[model samples]
Target: DLLTLDVDHLVVVTHGFTAGLLVAAWIGMPVASAGHVAFPVPSGSITTLREDGFFHNRAVVTVGDVAHLVGVSGS
Candidate 1:
């Protein structure tokens, strides 16, 4: 999956690594990450995860939600 965030003159970009971790957590999967990896992207980046819960439950978690992009146009 891809994640994007728009913040005025700057746009944040990040890979699915973090989001994947969230998914693993939600689905009871084994997750491993390297803490030494540096994030060179902007701080305003947003990542969203959609997953099915136990007993047919549904959940959505937005890390760094992009509410600021509302009504904005272009990329």
Candidate 2:
């Protein structure tokens, strides 16, 4: 596993869906990521409430997302 090497910070830059993002965080490494794509949102799911993977309880770093979408909207 890429995480078995003991990465202190993981930067994932890819167009991955929500499930992929969740898997990345589940890896248990401090994660910093940026992606340009959509994350599936089902009714009552965390993604539905948060509206973005960056909003999840992970250390992912998302650049260029609609800032206003999460109340942290900024240019």
Candidate 3:
């Protein structure tokens, strides 16, 4: 379903563990291989996924970036 979407960019918000699975799926990695992969997605953190050109352009731009929370009281 995700691969069929015709959009230049999309946003997905989900739990940390689920986020890792989504990333693995987006990059065509085997689900089994993702078993050991961990994507740190703390509350309010941001992750970025990008694709460019046509073939083999997928990329993980950022993982759990909380720059905006740098000065937050509870961060």
User: Which numbered prediction scores highest in TM-score against the true structure?
Assistant: 3
Candidate 1 per-residue lDDT over residues 26-63, each given as its tens digit: 44454453333422322455655453334735343555
lDDT of 3 by residue, 1-75 (tens): 766788777778888589888878878889789988877688888889888766758898898899989989987
How do all the candidates rank in terms of TM-score, highest first?
3, 1, 2
Give candidate 2's error at residue 4 in angstroms: 0.6
Model 1 segments more than 4 A misplaced = 1-16, 32-71
Clashing residue pairs in candidate 2 are 33-61, 67-73, 68-73
Provide the clash count, candidate 1.
Answer: 0
Q: How accurate is candidate 1 locally (lDDT)?
A: 0.46
Residues 1-75 of candidate 2 have per-residue lDDT tens digits of 654554454443444365556544553434555243334533222321122245535443432344344553342
Better of 1 and 3 by lDDT: 3
**Regions more than 4 Å wrong, model 2:** 16-75
Per-residue error for 75 in candidate 2, Å, reads 5.6
Q: Model 3, which residues run further than 4 Å from truth?
A: none
Q: All models: lDDT?
A: 0.46, 0.41, 0.82
RMSD of 3: 1.7
